[model samples]
Target: MPSQSLAYAVLFGHVAFIVVGALMTVLSQNLVRALVGLIMTLFGVAGLFFLMSAPFIGLMQILIYVGAVSILIFFAIMLTQSWSSGDEAQGPSRKRAVLASLTALAPALFLGLTIIFKSPPSLLVAEETEVSALGRFLLEPYILPFELISLLLTVAMAGAVILGFERRKQR
Candidate 1:
């Protein structure tokens, strides 16, 4: 258990950053600022992971998320054809988009709140230390899902390559 003072600081600080980061992600006009906000959001999520007693997950989130996803987003920006001046207004979306997003968000928020309030506190399952344990599970029990994830990664990489090549070829 954490010291009361320490826990309070961590929890409140994490929550504050999460809210501010979410606002930054949504409300920033500049794309780069939005990306920075996304990075902050990821960092705040990683902090929450640590608070939940999974330091390993927190480290992995920082390493895989901030390290890879942020760079990928920047690369995607550079690979695009449009380089507009910052002065142009990002006009509001059409009515259909507004309606569609709200339609999705309303149920999502409701379900999220319900789950948060209804769930029992979680207990930590014991950790197994043997490397062979994972191998046995992965190859025997979880083979289908494992291969599915691999296949998805392959398709995603191929799509990224095709799009990237097309952008450069047209330029």
Candidate 2:
């Protein structure tokens, strides 16, 4: 077990990762770089889950968000050929940037102020459930929905690929 100070330091580092990654994701002109930033943010969230002693959730976060979702976004970007265009080079107008910044800042500032002013409730210890039980539950009653979602995703990917091929053939 780590010391309290060490844990706080780790928590701060994870928060920093989330913040920096979020900024990169929102502000970067390059689609690939934004995707990398999104990955970083997902990783930071996973780290937080691990810090909270939810290893299963942390692994799921990495497996689903970092691995699956990021790849899906990357493939979507590639299929759309959005990154190859030079339109982003022109950049957003200063007024638009200011508006976007303010739009993001408002919620953050409100949340920060609420946290600072409000007295937090006592933390409750969560009951620890075995990973095997959770797995069994997911695989049993939820299996059909799970399989359906997988099928849907597969079909979507196939459709995207077919559309990409059609586009190529047209050009």
Candidate 3:
């Protein structure tokens, strides 16, 4: 077990990773760079899950979000070729930057105010949950939804590929 201060430091670092990655994702003009930032944010979230003693969730986050989703997005971006031509000529608009900053800050501000006003003890307390129970519940009761979501993702990927091919044909 780590010391309390050390744990706090690690938590802060993870939070910083999430913040910086989010900014990078939102602000970057390049699709590939934004995807990389998304990966970084996902990794930071996984780290936080591990720090909270949810190794299963952490691993799932890495496997699903970082490995699968990010790769899929990267592939789609590559296929679409949207990042290659006109992106460099146009810089980010000042209005978009201001809007993005405000959008990002709103949730943080709300959370901060909630933390300051609410009871910390209540916020800290969480119900003890077994990983096996969670797994069983998802596998048993939500299996249909799970399969449907997978199918949906597959369809979406196919659609993206088709769109990419169509765009290429048009050109």
Candidate 4:
């Protein structure tokens, strides 16, 4: 078993990543910077999952969010003509920024309060969930939501392709 100090250090690091990344995600003017921040946030979440003894979830967090989703966002931004390197300096209006800040803070505050006030649940032992069990759960009982998400991604990709082609044709 790891020492208490070491575990605390790791937890602190993960929380730092989560807080900084989340701030960057919402605060950055640049879209790519925001995307990078989002990836950082996801990476932090993966770290937390690993700490909780959920390696499968951590792997999925890194693979799906940091890898695929980030790449997709990068590609989408690259393919767009509206957003360029120069435009990164230009930020949204003050009203919009305040609203966005409030939007992000509200949920975070609620979560913090909930954690503070809630009593711990009683359990005999913390069960370790296997990746195979998760796979079965996704494919069996939650198949509809899973399939719907896949379909949504497919449609988004198709739309992006069509939009890219149209933009190229016009240029």
Q: What are the Cα lDDT values of the candidates?
A: 0.78, 0.87, 0.84, 0.84
Ranking by lDDT: 2, 4, 3, 1
Query: For residues 26-50, could you state the per-residue lDDT of candidate 1 as single tens digits?
Result: 6676667777889999999999887
lDDT of 2 by residue, 58-105 (tens): 999999999899998999788777672655656789999899889989
Compute the lDDT of residue 26 as modeled in candidate 2. 79
TM-score of each: 0.72, 0.72, 0.71, 0.72
For every candidate, C-alpha RMSD to the true structure in Å:
4.3, 4.0, 3.9, 3.7
Candidate 3 C-alpha lDDT tens digits along 1-171: 368778789899999999999988877878788888999999999999988777889999999998888988988788778683644437877898799889979998999899888945553323546889988988999999989999998999899788768744454
Q: State the TM-score for model 3.
A: 0.71
**Which of the predicted structures, 1 or 4, would earn the higher lDDT when compared with the native?**
4
Better of 1 and 2 by lDDT: 2
Best by lDDT, which number?
2
Give a tens-digit lDDT track for model 4, residues 95-151: 987888799789989998998789587553347898899899999999999999999
| Candidate 1 Cα lDDT to native | 0.78
Each prediction's number of clashing residue pairs = 0, 0, 0, 0
